[model samples]
Target: MYTEENTARLLPDVAVHAQPHLVGELDWVGMDGIEVPVRFDAGDGDVQRASARVGAFVNLRRPDKRGIHMSRLYLQVEQALSTQTLSTATLRDLLRGFLDSHKDLSDRACLSIRFEHLVRRPALRSANSGWRSYPVTIEASMIGEELLLEFGTEIVYSSTCPASAALSRQLIQDQFAKDFDAGKAVEHAAVLAWLGSEKGIVATPHAQRSVARLRVRPAEGAAFNLIDLIDVTEQALGTPVQTAVKREDEQAFALANGGNLMFCEDAARRIQKALDADKALSDFHIRVEHQESLHPHDAVAYASKGVEGGYAGKGCA
Candidate 1:
């Protein structure tokens, strides 16, 4: 068996860090798509353990260093995640560990984690419920001793076009006028039957599937409130997609969509207003996309909290 001392003597050890000829500081260097097991808090005092895809990086401040200890960064992430719950404090510790491991070479560290968060959603008008998965991403960066945390998620809903709805009402009114006679008594049952017939309902509004993607940074010392943000968004939109559905639930969903006719601009503003009301969030960026049924392309709008030097209203592609 070869010992550590014998191996070092037999092998050529290249001092890459000592090479001054190839000296240049790198903005970022490390690993991406690293698989790790992490524990997440569901904001209800429940802890969920799941596998997540992670990315870890650090900025090389030393010009003479050839490269960073990539394996050390990976190990640090694994160790930190295995020992702590997922939160702002956990992320700050993990990022600090990255810099600690590369003390002489790096001064700034960053980490990103992506996972699918599953939550149970009840039916609109039924006793049953089902699980819905939301794509979530958590990112953190540490520069010196300051750490910034960001959270992102996506919500899918229905958007009924306001223009199409008005047009449809006009057509229905025209159909009803043609079916009825001027100054004539109409039977209640006959009118009800006519309203249910195809001729009476000549047109229907066009509604399309829409998505709201948001990224937010919570205020300092505030806990990460993922479920609270989700609730606020769904309530503000008023037509979130349902998981479990019976006939009654389907009917309730239809009524909800009919009542909440909106354009892409409307959805974006609703989310912006809801986020503004939450004191826990300090900065945010939101984008709502209406996959138009009338047009081949999608209509999109963006909004932000407009904090100085914070996130701009950018598209989430």
Candidate 2:
């Protein structure tokens, strides 16, 4: 049955109301990419609310344009915020409500929570301390008889290239050895001055602020602790942020950084190696983003458990 008059007609001061027209249950429903500030730790009265962009994507399929109610998704997220400590467990409830929200209209649902995780950091070379933010994303889906949980985390650090350092070191040794062969004892300060100056340098390996991110599915369901995963991620990446750093800490950090000099490809390989060794990670995807200081663009490397397109190390290329 098709009627053009019914589609176009709108009442002029007429009291008439009808529910939305539905062909069938939806494949997915609910809102997505909605931004909200989430507060956890129900015990504390003065707990700070962490900012999280929270929303669900439920499975809905409707032949007609008008399908699931849009307001339901907003309400579910609001409900989550008003009551509940937002852990992996709570996200499942929000998804179940998402499906139940539509009743028979939806059979499956998906949800994603995106947030900027903040932690205090002390300056690398100074006493100043401030908060640094890392992008974090968590997503879950209800499909058929199984529920899937996925977690994503990112950490920022710096990388320095070691290959370039080795070549420069060799050049100085050769130059001094030749001078010594001619019965001339070259002053050590002269070698230092030449190498320290830009003239004697061919190309110094540059390090930049880097971001390491990982994605994984939890096998233990909602009870899984994402904090441990976060720690593992930071440890795998090598240069983690420091909260409280005195001069000694700063010196230690500098020593650590110099020792852990890595290229973008090296960082990726290092993470891949770590992932291969870790028992907790069954399936994972890791990406390293190096924000180059020498160049305006970033250098990146990606890796997976199966080693598909993942630059394991600089030797990989």
Candidate 3:
């Protein structure tokens, strides 16, 4: 019953997208919080599938256009992500698709995908292992013909205040001097009993949960190495929060914290040094936050590769 003429009359062709606009070229116009399934190559012959929150955008070069085809961006993102394993090459193609769909309306496009990356981490002193979720984000942008990619992640660890540790040690030494006369003969049993008593540890250093947020851009032809970057950061900090821990593991963690006392400055510097040694990352920005147990506010430090037009080393908090 539906002929071509009747169908054309029933649904009229609308040109709302070509409506006149007053503004000039807009910087970015697109959609955010689009839920999509993405596949990632783990670099070890493994592929990880995750549901991610995606943001897609493009620079609207034509001021006369009413708006960009937002649904087109979403559809392109969904199709590409569902079909291909994410990589620099695939991401470039995806962004290119954004421009292709828009054609003469846009020349620059950007995409941001955020998800939690899970890895099984072994206990510090136990045979057990548990999954740890690291919050991660991948950002890709194409300006004209140039494509830029950045990988970011957040790592949580323990930071013991170096100044607080030194002060605690001083107090403990003073307590020990008071408990046992320096010139008197120190008996083994008496020293052991004193060490076991509450008076022995007159003070304790303040340690608190800390976080390191890092964003890095890999060099040309380099792959996005999320796991490697996480490992390097955790190793440098020396006190990543554990998932499964027995008494021995807890003690080992305590020992690690004690040995690697750091202020926010130290934490940032350690990560900076480690990242600098890595050849894969061409530019990076690091922010370390020491949630102070002694103060109401947190202590924070930020560092960035001193490259021209690189990250500005701004603190997120």
Candidate 4:
């Protein structure tokens, strides 16, 4: 099955032929959902490897050309992404390499990589910790000499309904008034015993697991530190979901939720304010959704940096 004559034979390439099936330039033509390996620095002195789904595309500018070389794009992605640490500069080079392979047929190139980034999270007030996964997507596009980049991530937290909290407080106040007389001096031990009883706290506020989806455009020449972003987001929200918890940690989490009662609108505004104060991010879009425990429907809110020619908060895309 192997011979010198077979090796010398030419392989047919149909993509090189000029044909006129439909004579119009297409916006983008390439591949999506390509399986690839991505390596990146986690900023903790270790390079993490992630299984990613990659999308590579280049504009089809030549009307008469049958199709661009697709295998070239795949090979380049497999080669560069598997070995190199992912960064803005790396993505810029990869996009430029796409255009270089299709010299005459394409002028603009774009790429998208989606993966789950894992991080170790400690308990609220315990020594225990566990791994948590965050969904992340990085997008890059290059046209001529200019490159545009954006990254999106999702954070899960706990949200307690503010209105429900107020109603519960009112019920507790009414119960306290019924138990103690205003004109009489109440003993401290009796009050503590009543507060510890089940009938004393009549109602509890409703809380639900909520998610915050964010897209950000980093400032030029800034290091793309995802952990920093996550830290800031969790700090602003104040009630990040826990991984491992002891009794004390659970109590601490309850205290945090009690202190940080929020509506979906409140969560969005908090994130917006925090992001605005971060100089590393030039523009950002925030979308928060509270999966309501009381109602079947979810409550949501959206916000964006009000910068001209930036994210308009129109859609999550």
As a TM-score, model 4 comes out at 0.94
Residue-pair clashes per prediction, in order, are 0, 15, 0, 0
lDDT of each: 0.89, 0.67, 0.90, 0.92
lDDT of 1 by residue, 1-317 (tens): 68987985776546444576777888999899999888887687777787899999999888766788898898988998877889887888888889888898889999999988888889998999998898889999999999988999999999999999999999998988888986899899988999889987799999999999989998988876778888999999999999999999999999999899999999999999999999999999998999989989999999999888887744355
- Which has the greatest lDDT? 4
lDDT of 2 by residue, 1-317 (tens): 44777654542422122235535545555666677777543222334467787667665554444456667788888778656766666877877877787665567888777776555555656677876665667777876646777777777776776775677667756664654555766678987787676656544556677888777655463343445665566676667766667877778776777788888788888877876776655566777888877779888888777744332342422
Candidate 3 all-Cα RMSD: 2.1
**lDDT of each residue in 1-317, candidate 4, tens digit only:** 65888753666778767776667789999999999999976556577899999999999999889899999999999999999999988999999999999999999999999998899999988899999998889999999989999988999999999999999989999999988999999999999999999767899999999999999999998766788889999999999999998999999999999999999999999999999999999999998999999999999999999898988746654
TM-score against truth, every candidate: 0.94, 0.71, 0.94, 0.94
Angstrom error of the Cα, residue 39, model 2: value is 3.4
Pairs with steric clashes in candidate 4 = none
- The regions of model 2 sitting more than 4 angstroms off are 1-29, 40-48, 120-130, 174-204, 221-226, 241-250, 277-279, 294-297, 307-317
| Root-mean-square deviation per candidate | 2.0, 7.5, 2.1, 2.0
Span of 10 residues, lowest total lDDT, candidate 4: 2-11
Answer with 1 or 2, whichever has the higher TM-score.
Answer: 1
- Put down candidate 3 lDDT per residue, 1-317, tens digits, no spaces: 78987986776445345655455788999999999988886555578898999999999888777678888899999999988888999999999999999997999999999988788889999999899998889999998789999999999999999999999999999999888898999999998998888888889999999999999999999997778998999999999999999999999999999999998999999999999999999999998999888989999999988788888645464
